[model samples]
Target: MHRLKVQGVPLILKSIVQLLHFGYHQAMSCLFPVAIFGTLALSNVVHLPFIYRYDAILLVLLGVQYFLYRSGLETRDEIKVICLFHLIGLALELYKVHMGSWSYPEPAYTKLFGVPLYSGFMYASVASFMCQVWRRLRMDMTGWPGLASAALLGGAIYLNFFTHHFIPDVRWWLTGLVFIVFRKTWIIYRVREATYRMPLTLSFIIVGFFIWLAENISTFFNAWKYPNQHQVWHLVSFSKISSWFLLAIISVIIVAQLKYVKARRVWGD
Candidate 1:
């Protein structure tokens, strides 16, 4: 029994190392979240529930995505702009916690005022990773209205939220206002990058689609429990999702407009 127990310890450690030391390729990392979801689905046979665990693992995929970023694909200045997005997002989260825009009654852990540090790191990392992947692959960013479209899209989403009584959180509203004002400022002061135009529009489109998928899936689960938020018309909820999608696109824009993103896959550019 002692020998058996000793042998099993190494096997457990090996499994962990394999999982954590996984590959860094973009396609593999992007699908990591889906693969985790599949495992969670399969585990139902063993009478195990895996909602939170899967979320954490999905977050870990993003944690790994961070190192994949390459220097050629984007500039140092562009990276600073990307970092600014995180600063804004983290500040918004702080407001959320402060205003009770959202709250955790009894979290399993408390790393940063009811939210884990990994929550911020994973999100910020994923943003940089995803943008770099598409930028590197030369994924058709051709001929999008670029900044103008971003502003219009952001405005439309914000307006919908304002129109609905469901938009109660002042912080959320102010957050939307921040992006709007930022875009206008980018247009005015950032003369060169502001007029440069996007290499592709689908980057934003694809991100938006993913956000919709997540929101729809959450609504199905009833875990998030949005109030009276149907697909057709739910003001605050719709605004929130739309805002997320728009903001991600705006991140791309902020990075791209600063000439941060560069096509690196070519033999030599």
Candidate 2:
């Protein structure tokens, strides 16, 4: 028994080391997101002269993006992906604010139809995270559906976000299609020589839950206000998790397609 206990020590140490490595990679992947949230929190407390808080935040985020790119933290292709997400997110923000779904409720030179320009960074950060984590984890997918099917699902998910206001919400139908589309899919990731596999849908749910938590933090920092949060800062509705979950699906599909394309190019070469 003493010899068996002694042998177990190496296994325990190995597990601890793997956990540390995982945490470190996750932190690195979250660099962009952490920067955005830090800016939001700091802008709330620190006021700069001759600049509105929102505008200042926007400038600071732009600087951060430049620094990240110049410092080689984000590659050129990743920057392009992030920019795409920024535009996509900005469009959604514009429509949602117009529909009274949410309000920025702050004055800024950078406000476009009541939505701050910095608002796009929040979405860009998600793409940034996806890119960073994918590279760090050496992630790949198996049993992926055809590109057309995947694109259709992602496009439908995005459109539903807008169309639901006018038409009956078909989010549940979309959600069902998500499961169906990814039924055979698995995400394979590596950590320090050990490999792991998780269902693609499960990864979406996990990422969505964390994003929901981040949303609560963002609202607490007065990043944006829902109808109920206008008076006082409160926890965001849990139902928002479903929205983030769908959004997560969109983000993943975009990143996955890019990776797939890159792989095809390499094979062709």
Candidate 3:
């Protein structure tokens, strides 16, 4: 019995070590997002001379991006992808703000069509997290759908975000399609030496929930305001999770496509 107990000690120690490694990688992957949130909170408390809070936050984020690139934390290709997400997000914010879905009450020279330019960074941060975590974890996927089908679905999901406001919300329909499309998909990731797999859909939900939590934090900092939150800051509605879930799916598809293209280029070379 003593020998058995002694042998088990290595297993326990290994488990602890792996957990620490996982946590370290996760923190590293969240650097961009942490920077964004930190800027939001800091800008709220500290006023800069002559510059509006939103504009200040944008400048800080741009500086952070430049630092990340110079530090070799983000690759050039990754930066391009992040910028693409920024454009996509900015377009959505423009439409949503126009529809009165949310309001950026703070005055800023960077405002366009009633939306702050910095607002795009919130979406770009999501792409940053996805890109960082993918590399850190050495992630890959199995049973991925065809590129055409996947892109079509992703495009549909995005269009639904706008179309829903005009027509009946087909979000649930798209959700069901997501399940069907990705039924056999699994995301394989490595932590330390061991590997694990999880359903891709499950990952979307997990990421969505976390983003919802981040949204609450952003709103608390007065980054933007929902109608209900304008009077008093409170928890964002739980139903927003569904919207984020779809957004997560879109992010994943975009990143996955980029990865696929890179891999093909490498193989061809």
Candidate 4:
């Protein structure tokens, strides 16, 4: 009947809309990593001015950032956040390279303290991807703690990475703290017509795993080398996943400052 046909039409149209929206977001999320991998592949093959490869990588990353903002794929606010991530990542890279945590193993005009400037852009790319996905997917959260709690934890986690070289590693303790603080937190993400949810801590681990995989790709392209890989490329040790998991906590805290919904519970309790 006409009434039944009219009712079915809205449902069909809604499904199509949701599917398209989901695909759009998925593609946007893939763009950053694809660009990085593509550039890395090309850098291996292309010949240019002495040390120009590293400079090229830096320019490519900067160009991508500019394009994203110019194209309105990233808002001014998101660009600012990505810039902050770049500085943070660069600082860590400086310290890590100084500590001999990883080696660039290549001469480059853009080298500073033996780390290429483009290394920072790798971290920025993560923020760019996360920001894009957040906007595209309409991400939301619940049960988030106060900003102080997250900032304090995130700050300590970052400092620990450097301090661990001199003192006891408290990463395990911090990991416990993350669970305690975020145990009730849930990340709500949309895909197609339905919204799905996952615990925030678990999401960190999952994201960390993927970043670890991405790390393999980066190292494959000789982005940086662990001590073990000085002679031959090898799979990054799985233990690094723990570090990525903790670093992801810091990333969430920073991104959440831009937009995160508190849970329906008393803050102090």
lDDT of 3 by residue, 152-257 (tens): 9999999988988879999899999999999999999999889989999999999999999999999999999999988899899999999999999999999998
Give per-residue CA lDDT, model 1, range 1-269, as digits (tens). Answer: 99999999998986665444333335443542343334334432333244443345335544443433352444454355446655655655555555545433323332466543333432354456554554434333333345566556554544443443465535355445445444333221112122223323334445665656654553343212233543332424545555565556555555554442233433344
Task: Rank candidates, TM-score, best first.
Answer: 2, 3, 4, 1
Superposition TM-score, candidate 4 onto the true structure:
0.87
Candidate 2's TM-score: 0.98
- Candidate 4 regions off by >4 Å? 1-23, 49-51, 260-269
On the 0 to 100 scale, the lDDT of residue 191 in model 1 is: 21
Candidate 4 overall lDDT versus native = 0.86
Candidate 3 vs 4: which has more lDDT:
3
TM for every model, in the order presented, reads 0.45, 0.98, 0.97, 0.87
Q: Where is model 3 more than 4 Å wrong at Cα?
A: 1-4
lDDT of 2 by residue, 46-104 (tens): 87888998999899899999999999999998999999999999999999999999999
**Models sorted by lDDT, best on top:** 3, 2, 4, 1
Find the 10 residues in a row with the least total lDDT in model 3. Answer: 157-166
How does each model score on lDDT? Answer: 0.45, 0.94, 0.95, 0.86
Q: Give the higher-TM-score candidate: 1 or 3.
A: 3
Which residue pairs in candidate 3 have backbone atoms (N, alpha carbon, C) closer than 3 angstroms, thus clashing? none
lDDT of 4 by residue, 1-269 (tens): 99999999999998898788877887887676678878987897886765578778888877877887898878897888888988999999999999999999887889899989989878877787778887777788899898899999999999999999999999999999999999999989988658978899998998899889999998988888999999999999998999999988888888876664322233532
